[model samples]
Target chain A: MPKLDTAVVGLDIGGTSTRATVLTLTGQRLGSGRAGGGNPTSHGAERAAVELLTALREALSDFDPARVVAGTIGLAGAGRLLADPAGRAAFDQAWQDAGLRCPYAVHGDALVAYASGTAAPDGTVLIAGTGAITAQVRDLRLDRIADGHGWLLGDAGSGFWLGREAVRRLLADLDAGRTPGTLATAVLTELLGSAEIASRPRATVDATIQAVTRRAPVELARLAPLVVDAATHGEPVATALITEAAAHLAESVGRIRAAGAVTPVVLGGGLLTADTPLAAAVRVEIARQWPDAPLRTAGDGAAAAAWLAARDLPEVTDPAALHARLFPAP
Target chain B: MPKLDTAVVGLDIGGTSTRATVLTLTGQRLGSGRAGGGNPTSHGAERAAVELLTALREALSDFDPARVVAGTIGLAGAGRLLADPAGRAAFDQAWQDAGLRCPYAVHGDALVAYASGTAAPDGTVLIAGTGAITAQVRDLRLDRIADGHGWLLGDAGSGFWLGREAVRRLLADLDAGRTPGTLATAVLTELLGSAEIASRPRATVDATIQAVTRRAPVELARLAPLVVDAATHGEPVATALITEAAAHLAESVGRIRAAGAVTPVVLGGGLLTADTPLAAAVRVEIARQWPDAPLRTAGDGAAAAAWLAARDLPEVTDPAALHARLFPAP
Candidate 1:
């Protein structure tokens, strides 16, 4: 089921989750593993390193780790990890603990995200998952970036922003003593734990506030999917949030493109994946804003990391064909 | 010496800090005390109660606690405290711990902030301190509110919003590999602890992120002052943030006013305090949006609580004179 020593490891460490894969030098998938959030920016380096190494160890269990010739790990806020002595030390120790025998490359998520979407070295890439940010890829490297300010200060079109706006609209309606609209109803159902709590508006409102304040603020991103569901059910407030999210994403792209040429723009991250309502709205808005620019949806970021790692292997002379083989239709 | 029996204890519990004052029925300030944040929504009811009681007890120490005729405390998100059993227990215990002898009342900050300004029984009160919210006060009670949505979902023009925007602007500049603008420079200095770190852009960026990530998200509000300084120095990005803050505040006011008759609108909270850039912009925008609405700046929220407490005392008549004496010309 799996092969070793003829592959490379590709890993994606995100704010909310971590994923890893082993791929043959010719881009054949060998094995894969998934784990909880391992972003050192939020989880601290020790925990992040442990989670990351665990994911890698699990993926390699079916194969010999010694056979892996190269590896690449893509993560956001990696600069913070590299800057901290303990953070860097923990990462080094994690590799040692995992018993990896390979040349490892650690790159920021921005780099891998760009590669995940397009073969071009120059273009724009936008990600709108738990957080949102846009970067210009020039000569296969991340250049100027827009937003990505994290949960507190920015991330305008992020899942966190969408989810927060949904709760806000719900609370505003409850405060007005208005009958629950579909969006508010759905949001409350999810946030307060049941539709039965609807009759007790004050208690519901109070409980919602207490519950939200009790958890990490970033966890609000988990609520973004509810907004999408409401919008699909024709909730005006949810529709408006999607519209605003698209506008914010478009503006971020505009800011990035203002300083450089428009090669092609790639959209990435969970919030803007596939045919989701948010993604559809973003596509429409992006067209209106930049009709001449080419737009594409990114493949799996973790897969992209593996492809990037495998492309440089001696046997992988035709990286594009290898990528096609690894990522078959559908 | 301050008068006894005639005195009242009034407390203002904020997300960032707490303050308390003892006032005579005549509305003369007797003593005051301050402590760290005591908002149950942010710090949990136990910590909030401890801080609130500590501040109140500190203010009561100068005079016999038995002499207090009335006591009032105003805080945001108080509904959460009153609704949760543990939260309520904490408050009751805190009162016993403080040994306050008077019949005490706890009201939302909206009520006290309204009383802090004009004598109008119906109008509006907008606070934009550590958090932002606007309320329509009818008959001296908060009838309806707009955007008091806590740090997680709202508080758009708050200190937290301002501070977050500052750091975001800094990161944008760093991402562009451009020399720091005044706003970025000021933000980096305040956030990273030194402007000298600017010489090493990567380290500076990494350190700033580490510092921000290491602290609680809401603590971003502490960086608000740096934004003001940059705006004062004519930084365009900082100016834009102030302008946006003003718009958000004004829109919140509009939301509250839309549901009620036009009456006096009083602005409170740290960001909207007299003469701040945001305050001035809000005034300009508010005047343009509602030319006939009366506008005033609220006196200290704690002082308002004391004044409101004094007004309710049987011996206290002529509340206008009492408020005049308590707030003076400041």
Candidate 2:
């Protein structure tokens, strides 16, 4: 099979959604596509792999898929896929279906996010999305990870945790027959309804609980941004939740790092990527521990995946140009 | 509609199990039976009602259903039942099926547990079982509750919380490539078969996590006993978990109590009932806060409900004898 020297593919598979990109080896964008959640760990491996292929197919429609020289896929909970033969078969089947004869490797999302953020291969990546996890990279290999316990057990600084805390405060206020603060009021309004729940706080609390219990527990994460919005408006309870979340995230990084190492700390996930108070507080908290450490937000993971794939190629290419293209100034 | 002066019925509908008991007005136990869970909040109201009736029928098989006079039912999260029309209909259907002629009222389990434990009408009940919750009571009515947020949100100090903490420590130890402690070792053995998981710590950790993720999140409570056993064997991680659990439970009680009030503090639920270190530590913590407050363990809630029903009757009775009959030694 002859390779198309100009073509490469990159993918970022997450719990919520998956994105795929096709670009030239010389950093010219060719195609991009998106599909539903493709985290094999959250969704089944077979479904995730099919979704990944769906996105890749859409992205490679303009080019020959077989011509792509290399490809990389980053996913959370990738261990489950690797641990099962059926799961591995799903990946192979997806690759074959996409008509890709090129070589590709699957990597943990934490590693790819770190690679996307900084050129340094020995730093850390802290992600606080629906779930929270921190990983340490020593010379580009993931050395250790901490606190990605999912919503049921841990994910201390994650969206689910914050939202759950907000509802708990609201319920407590309702039980105590006290007027809810700005944070609780906003949370209840979003959870129950606009007008009917306004007067009956206890009923609102009951309905909120009933709703969450009847649905998926992960759906509670949807309420997290409202909490952030309340905090931005100076709600003390919301502010306290943000402070605690930052502390938890910082603690996760501290648990993996040694004393006085000037490692680059890369932040990823929607909570940190948004220009919000929680994001700013997390940055401040990280700086408190490593006074001189550089902080960076991750570029598009799909682009980083391409860079990862292209890094092993036998040609010299400008990595900085790819970074500039993927993460253009806003 | 004739009431049986000699017979009274009581029922406890819970998330995991439903129990019913028939007793004479003088506290002579006639029959008792247990069936599947009947918590309308966890299971839908229709199923809960059916299960409740099934338990009652089994207990009442030896007696006339119409003879079950002055019945009382204790249900957890009963508000959900009250709010839904179909749920209310299920309750009505069960009542009609049972042929009850006497007055009956459904009360929250927290209130019934308080009545079961102490002679005083105003006090508190701290329950730490599959879940953890504390309620303040005044004159037999529930005043307020704390920390009953279910496994997904709160329930801090619960069996699920302890189990979750154990697995977390196990994962951390596995990630750090450290030797398994007593707690981790026991948890792995229970989650995976002992013979297969004994040697490979990393595989065991992965298997443990994979197994938990596949099941209902609340099933984490099944692992709590292993942690308690490890703590008893002096594993530092397990010991720390139990201590934290005690602190959380005590804090819940503190949230509801008044300063310098000599109110009784009743303890309920399996974790507190068992002669474990958690229960002992909770007693010590409670004593520290309320030096003069009496500490009591609740008798069977079904018996308490029956007693509550019988208390209003014109016939005088020996309360001490009834308590002794319900919670006999061993």
Candidate 3:
């Protein structure tokens, strides 16, 4: 079962961090490394490339780079970055500097996330973290998508959407002279930095509104976890918000999914990957929509990337077994 | 009922422009002037005061300022401006420089909008222009308000809300590979500067999204009129948007309105004051909720301010009759 001195490398470039892992063809861990954000869309191409190189070098420190049979990279904003000449050049330079002789494949982050959940080549992936989007994946590539329009226009069932609804509900209660519910009170305390402000309804409402609008709109996503916490405690407002979010997310998947087809459904992103009320609610909603579909939560992305690299190698005959070894059921 | 020498001065300070009018006690217009924005919330207190003085001087150019007995100013952000010492000092200095010895009163813009519709001392005023807010007025002063939380948090049923919904629907259609409807096509032409981009669905969707997000988020309000126009031509998507907007606006009113109360209801702002489908839908919704409430559209704000100035004078015995003479029946 052991591979003789043959290894593979994988990288996951995200907006917040870059992760790299080196693994044997049999899924044994060789080395791993982490670095700052390497997404060219947020950080410039040059800096992203440099960070990518830093993570890659660290991961390959204890392994022989020459023995690597294959490599794979999962990148956010892959299309935008690869389409630009400068971005492509920076990435090429990084790969060359790593002294890797093996051929490598690059894929969109969504596809890699789908691979992280299951070995299925055709399925759907729904991500509902800070933003929300659903995509239909065929042969491990994104084929169609819905509702990834970001926080400004869409992202209907996202963390940002939940947070905004919490604040709006608080404002409505204050305006109506009714006491805010537990969830709204928690949101006010979090945003205004104190629960004492709740005594003065009018002034507190005005200050809370100002406090939220003054900052970046996306920062509202920070309150999503609080919503989940309150819902876990049986808060009605938060429970309702979670239900609505689940419905919206299910609708997004329904838009791209085939009717009466029970394909695999992979749930990614922080909201779905975590063991939260929203995750459970989404599972129920998706099951109601497609009862026969197999639901899976995404695992470690770097490990998944490594598995993808090893899957196509001549030595790895059973890709599904390799995938199961890499990401066992929780 | 002509007054020999008494006159009144009124100023309406808004975010876009400032207007001042001099009127005789008998509701006859003596002189009027207009200038740039004088809302201290947008323009600083110093510049707002300067503009106010300029408009006052121009309005009094043909009339004797000494004969003006009372003055009234309806200002946006009245509370914030008056609460700050710097803002108060600026307005005081400007008032002293204007050569008026008469006393004056300051009221929130909502009150002035209510007065523009009816002479009733108490009512509810709903505004749904670039933003949406509903207020209860008691004795011509703001009593309570609902849903003025701005674009980021609330402002449901607003122009910005309608515009955002239109863009979101277009994106949804594009993501689902469905041909966009007339309303979405019009919005695309407006944002992308041409409909030719529609030939390339994927690239055009990406470009259109980038174009809208790259600018100020509030600029989405510019697309509201397009939704209304399309709905006028019997577009289903636009008609649905208008219906939802009307429902939201009516719901906002219902939040603060007293059940079965028949006090006057004044509808202000561009969406309600104008003759449009949204206006008709809103009227129908509001009437269904409160069948006996008299619904009226707001008229010239400056004239309303002038009438407010003359409302409590010794010579003006009948204020309601004067208001009718000033605004008249539309």
CA deviation > 4 Å runs, candidate 1: A1-110, A138-147, A195-203, A254-262, A285-293, A300-306, A313-318, A321-330, B1-109, B196-202, B232-234, B258-260, B300-330
Better of 1 and 2 by DockQ: 1
Interface quality of candidate 2 as DockQ: 0.30
CAPRI category for model 2: acceptable
Per-residue lDDT of candidate 3, residues B1-330 (tens digit): 348578999999998899999999888899998889989998999999998999988998998888899999999899888789999889888877888889888888989999999999988999999999999989988888888888898889899999999999888788777788899889999999876545546677788889898888888999999999998898999999999999989888988899897999999999889988999999999899999999999888888999999998878999999998998897
Candidate 2: C-alpha lDDT:
0.81
lDDT of 3 by residue, A1-330 (tens): 348599999999988999999999888899998999988988988999998899999999998888898988898788888789998888888988988888788888888889999999899999989999898999778888888888998899899999999998988888888777898889988988876555557788799888887888998999999899999999999999999999999988988898776889999999999998999999999998899999999877888888889988889999999898898888
Identify the runs in model 3 with alpha carbons over 4 angstroms from their true place: A197-200, B197-200
TM-score of each: 0.77, 0.81, 0.96
* Model 1 Cα lDDT, one tens digit per residue, B50-127: 898889778877777778778888887777677899988888877777877667788898788888887778888888
Highest TM-score against the true fold, candidate:
3
> What C-alpha lDDT, on a 0 to 100 scale, does residue A302 get in candidate 2?
87
Instruction: Grade the docking of candidate 3.
Output: medium
Q: Predictions ranked by DockQ, top down?
A: 3, 1, 2
Ranked by TM-score, top first: 3, 2, 1
As for candidate 2, its clashing pairs are none
Better of 1 and 2 by TM-score: 2
